[model samples]
Target chain A: MSDYNGQAGDGMNWQPGLRESYIFDRNTIEEIRRAASQGIYDIRGFGAKRKLPHFDDLLFLGASMSRYPLEGYRERCDTSVTLGTRFAKKPIELKIPITIAGMSFGALSGQAKEALGRGATMAGTSTTTGDGGMTEEERGHSEILVYQVLPSRYGMNPDDLRRADAIEVVVGQGAKPGGGGMLLGQKISDRVAEMRNLPKGIDQRSACRHPDWTGPDDLEIKIEEIREITDWEKPIYIKIGASRPYYDTQLAVKAGADVIVLDGMQGGTAATQDVFIEHVGLPTLACIREAVEALQEMGMHREVQLIVSGGIRNGADVAKALALGADAVSIGVAAMIALGDNDPAYADDYAKIGSAAGFYDDWHEGKDPAGISTQDPELSKRLDPELGGRRLNNYLRTMTLETQTLARAAGKSDVHNLEPEDLVALTIEAAAMARVPLAGTDWIPGRSKDGF
Target chain B: MTTATDVEVVDLATTPLRELNQRLHDGAAGGPLRWRIVNPNGAHAVAVGVDAPFEIEIEGHTGYYTAGMNKHAHVRVNGNVGVGCGENIMSGTIHITGNASQACAATGRGGLVIVEGDAAARCGISMKGVEIVVKGSIGHMSAFMAQSGALVVCGDAGDSLGDSIYETHIYVRGSVEGLGADCIEKELKEFHREELGRLLTAAGADAKVDEFKRYGSARRLYNFNIDHAGEY
Candidate 1:
């Protein structure tokens, strides 16, 4: 099948010159063939590969005559962020606005989890645990770890909850919001089986909903039970995929969350159907304003911290999300990249698995040459946690420095001081979603004249 | 407020729920090991999250998540209990004299839950390793997705007794309305009968093991299949 090199076109009247039909493109034909033969939907890892309106569509408006810009080298731009300030006695204090998002021990290697902990600690930030229970490698290395409470409740015990620095109740994931997690028998090792309390080598299916409770009312009780179990010491966060941000954020707030973690469609998954990842949740840019508006409407914008994730790469994206009113940001796929995932050095090994270096995303296969996403003992030893941690730290430092550069250009001393007026959209779709004016125009599409 | 040797009485009418839980967590370090809570009045999260080994008794009704996530504690509620009673329990003993609400003992792991009266819907839902015995009937969707545990019911069960169950052993003496997808009735083997007899005797229940039927996972849906693509 042909790759996207200007092959697809709108015109399809017995197309000549190798011009492919837009609707029935080469990829679509290949997918149909595979489905007809295999009779199953294609399941893969990674986030949405399709292009959408992103932070790149928004440009920062530097200071000119009306506004004064700060000195590039001399001015200090504060990047510290304090999360979970609404209800917790002990909140997270980060040196940078970026944090490492949750990636499970089962989906990722134990060494990779260790590396993330070591790096986040070096960067003066926190790392989060994912669908699987907390492993000692991460908990022992990480200075501050946020434990996740998912629908499956796998390896969910009171001891881990008490030891966690914070708790995140996962309502849904961005890649598959209403879906459950899938771990093929190939990935469920002896440790994974024991931890999850399931049989060895049996395909595991995580339930989509919490076993005890159903909706918001039950969410309140669940949060309360967690708080009670932890003695009300740790901050409680509610994570929602970007489906209906306005209502979900409000309900999470009402459920007594100290922080809200919003993940968009571009958020990465370990293993899920390809169709659901591409079609489900809203884009990161589309949900930021809506979520921020919900928090602002409740007068809890900064009081209850908002950590936005999915498609976050560098400092510009970080600044754009913050300018759109997010308190902080979380990174998952970027962190994996920082720890040497999909690096060109393993191109030879990747090719053996029927993939190229940058194109390889079969994390669920558990044969990752980089040792980051696999459970194979031999392959896992390829990653040196210390070196991976250093690389991740360097990447995080660079992103922080880049964010400071952007903040200085906008004449701001603190990163959080950047406002919506400092940015303009390069496209109408982005302008409508980000609620920012289009470049060289005073109008934001679909916004009312009264600005309400 | 009794002294050192006596059972301390905490009246929910006068005291706060948080205070009672805190006292329970204190775990006889400063007071008596036995506690009697009065005027529970259907309060949610009553006597929850106590990891310490203590005997807690509630005289009146309690609300959601009562004795939830319990560890090593023995709790008894004389009146009715609300939703998610003894949920995610690690190790404990919970006895309820009155009927229980929905999701009772849901996701409980390694515990013994006994309900003298009927249990509402989704009873023992997703139970990991807990042993639950209900003297009366259970509502619909009981033991749904229950993973390694045993649920015993004396009276009739509602619709969908064991939907999508995994490894959980269900023994019902009375009639079962129906079995759910991926759940089927299994023959009562000798070991199962002995296990049922032991569980019944442990719960102080007077029931014959010969009249009960066992239901468990059919194991057909244990792995994914291309032919059953529509199920997903």
Candidate 2:
């Protein structure tokens, strides 16, 4: 018999010479070309675009004949969450569990910052500040704001510290855990420069660690200093990228954190090396149980509230996070999307930037057509804060309703009532990471099969 | 918390360090303009984040982050200090009579910190707008990545001086072990000499301007470039 191989194109039979490399695929080839031409690593905005095991890997079993369900229409499913109850004199009380994650005014438009604040306020949740110091517009619009203390210490001051409702000491971000923040020269506007106390139009690389302190012991003193600075009123949250969740969680708790904000690999960034963003940190689902176990081992599960972030998309993700032991969930990219990022309406404008609407993530370029990520005056004016805020509020409400529907179906009167027993994993990898039973089977892969 | 007002000193040995800091902060807006902190006994974050215009003196030793983020307070420590003394000070002064450990005046912005004794590594590291003067020598990595400030060392400087330095000015009277990447000796013009003289007067260090050499950023690495990888 004559040897014959089929010709290949898009999804066609693989041809001999035209076969794609498993190691160096077409996308990989393009990246190589880009690196060869530019002589620099790929620096881009947004989180890891690669697919990872996320909340979708897990599913909830609805109440059946054996387990009774609650009446969805008439019954109530509570969504309220309280954080920072362990230490702060004034703990954050939220109407919903979902909050707006810190997106810097330098990374986003001032209008966008205002919009996020307005939306969070309308939803009765808290909004957070980012690398750049507090903006008047941001503080004025949001009733409750969490000020972030970063490695750079750019515009860190006492007035802003006292003004903040809470203080989050950022150890690392999910996008680049061990790496520092990178702000391209392109995004450094006059206002952004003034806030960061750097020269305008200079590429800024922030520190990877704090200048003054290091380690858990030093962190305890640092936390105390901030508490003293703020008169022990505001909650001090330790936000860390999920690399060693068990050890990091223990260290953060030991460091005197009122709350722990854990971010997974799917978290977004304003700007960072593409390689670092995709390579570092654990996925959100993989991190939760380890963190929960650590907190539980320390007998501080609910005492020190846990807020999970990174890759949170829909109400399903929120419910799954809560089910896995997170007290609350924070959103960044989703909130940006709700603020008109990557919308089909701006498809033509995105094309001008050499991208499609949903495909555009060059936030570091500061040429966002949606006006949410850009610092340009003309581009930023496109977004009216009031309208954007209303849209975000609508999205938050929709998510809350979806969560409530699922919770009622699961017979959970309070959203926090859902537990891991109600969950089943679709994949073995997920079953192992989430420590949940495989669907239609009681096997959790790593755990003993014995029921006792 | 012991408040012995008769001696005009707040004793940290008897008073909780937290209460002392709280008093320092709560009184900053409208508290005592001047006070003495006795028996500091190496307490961390003593007199930190004081916003009000006050003059406080610490009698003994201190631990990490002493007078950190000081806004409007003038604090003086009679004895030695641990790591990160006068970190992130803003519009105030921190004077240490004895030696200081690592990261002295780290990230200080718009304040003056004078260490009579030598400072360990990373003095004035990432300094913003603060002015620091050291009577004795400074350890290695001094003024690394300093953004905007002035670091004056009356004695010698250790290795890797001003590595990856920014706009901050450095003046050293004694020998320099080595200059770090992108750091070069600049001409000590009349302008710099006069500024050095002023800083010297502030630190109370008696050093001739003619004996000192100045160093600053070459500014080559202000923006990223592949050719400058060796420098980084």
Candidate 3:
């Protein structure tokens, strides 16, 4: 037995070698060299690239011998959601649980904002305003609009606040929590400059924290002030990143917030340092339970609605989030993709800018070939609002159908009835993090009286 | 008692602010030429979103956001305001007879805010094109991250004044505790004195214009300088 030493038959028998560079992988070496040469951190759009525990780790247990399943097409599974019912004089009602997350008009074109509004309106959902301010086009097209009051207060006005159906006071973002917003000089077009009241070609950096308040007590006063200004007709939502969801939710509820918007690390940003996007904040899977626990502890589980965002891509993700105790879910990057971002039709244009179809993340450069993120007039003309709106409507309808299908299989009458009992984790890490029973076992990893 | 002009008097105690504001906002073209609000006992959002070319007279103290988003309206508050006295004023004039709380005239785009008494912290913050004239001192971090326009303080400024400021010009009659990042004292030239004098007259200040020292952007941190990212 010559130990199979014959290499000629195996086509030269090259050994499979692993690169011995932990600190200098190809991508990491490129980043290091780029940072050293440019003397600045790399800034780009999109969410985190590093993988984390997500909804895919959990599986729903369909109806079996003990439970009877509902008919998929016959039995009704309602998905309607009502937000801001706690303190708002008028709460927002949506036919579906999915919403369009905030993306600023400055980061996106006017046509794109209009498209988002039209699509969300047609789909019977709500759209949000992002950093710079609300546009009239967005307001006119959207049936229900959530106006964001950011730290910058760029185009904030009393009239606009009154006009909005709901108000979202943004404390932090998932991409760069506690970091200010950055819109480079190239993106600051004339209209954007006029709206934000900045010079046309100057870089605009928004404030990291609100200038008016320093603590939760002052936030209470500020919320009250907004309430007084709007006569309490609109719902006030507090949006916080997933850094400290438990305490943030508690404080927001204490400050009399009608709704809480929790964005995880996977949430997309128009522009931020690549390092912050990947390294900061908690995973979406880890954020939900803590926020739900906080709300449950305060006896505000259902009284104050919880809207979760950050990497929600489809109906299963929506169902999983709802099962984990979220009232609704919002989407940003997925919506843009459905609206024709990173399309193959613009591959040549992307190639001209040293990028490819699915890898383009230079939204801050103001050269988007798909016309969704850029402010260029010619590029913006490429996107037709009516067509984009139709595509978004189709996507939303599909997601709703998929969610309803899952709910029917689980023998649930309503989508909101999906509970943690119906889900099981595929891995021990997920079981411990999501606090669900591991696959066929009756045990959750960390549920014992003594530490596991 | 009706004034000579087209004056509509509304007592805050009787009329709801929503109804009154709706009437005022909806009827801006056909509404009264002037409005006089009485018995405003620290009411919030008094005379807010008044877009028409009119005049508003508040007889008593107002809460937050008094005359906020005032477009083409002249508002006069007889007593002190709680906070954000003239926030986001587009184009108009807000004259506060008494002291102002934090963030007075914040993010004002195009207007004039005249504070008769002292202003608290973050006064004239993120101000753009709106001239804010304070007759008395301003608290810490006044004019913080101001993008444009001019902030005039007749009295002393608190700590870290004009921090990370942009093109906004800060003129002070009294001492400044310290200059913030990228903020420096500029030589008060003849043109600056003239500008300060005009602002003083507009704000109804009796202080000498030449006694004020000017501070402005040193042109640092205007672009994304890596060395200044720490300040950001």
| CAPRI category for model 2 | medium
Considering TM-score, which of the candidate structures 2 and 3 is the better prediction for this target? 2
Interface RMSD of the predictions, in order shown?
1.0, 1.2, 2.6
Scanning candidate 2 chain A in windows of ten residues, the lowest lDDT window is: A1-10
* Tens digits of lDDT, candidate 2, B1-232: 3232322469998999888888877774554578799998988888888887788899999998888889887889999998998888888899999999999998888889999999999999889889999999999999988888899999999999999887899999999999898899999989899999999988878888899999998988888898897776
**DockQ for the candidates, in order:** 0.70, 0.69, 0.46
For candidate 3, report its TM-score.
0.91
lDDT string for model 2 (A312-389, tens) is 989999999999999999999999999999989988999998899887888988899999888989999989999999
Steric clash pairs (candidate 3): none
Q: What's the lDDT for residue A103 in model 1?
A: 91
TM-score of chain B of each: 0.95, 0.95, 0.95
Rate residue A143 of model 1 by lDDT.
Answer: 92
Candidate 1's TM-score on the B chain:
0.95
Model 1 - which docking category?
A: medium
TM-score (0 to 1) for chain A, all models?
A: 0.96, 0.95, 0.95
Residue by residue across B66-104, what tens digits does model 1's lDDT show? 999999889999999999999999998999999999999
- Top-down DockQ ranking: 1, 2, 3
Docking quality of model 3: it rates as: acceptable
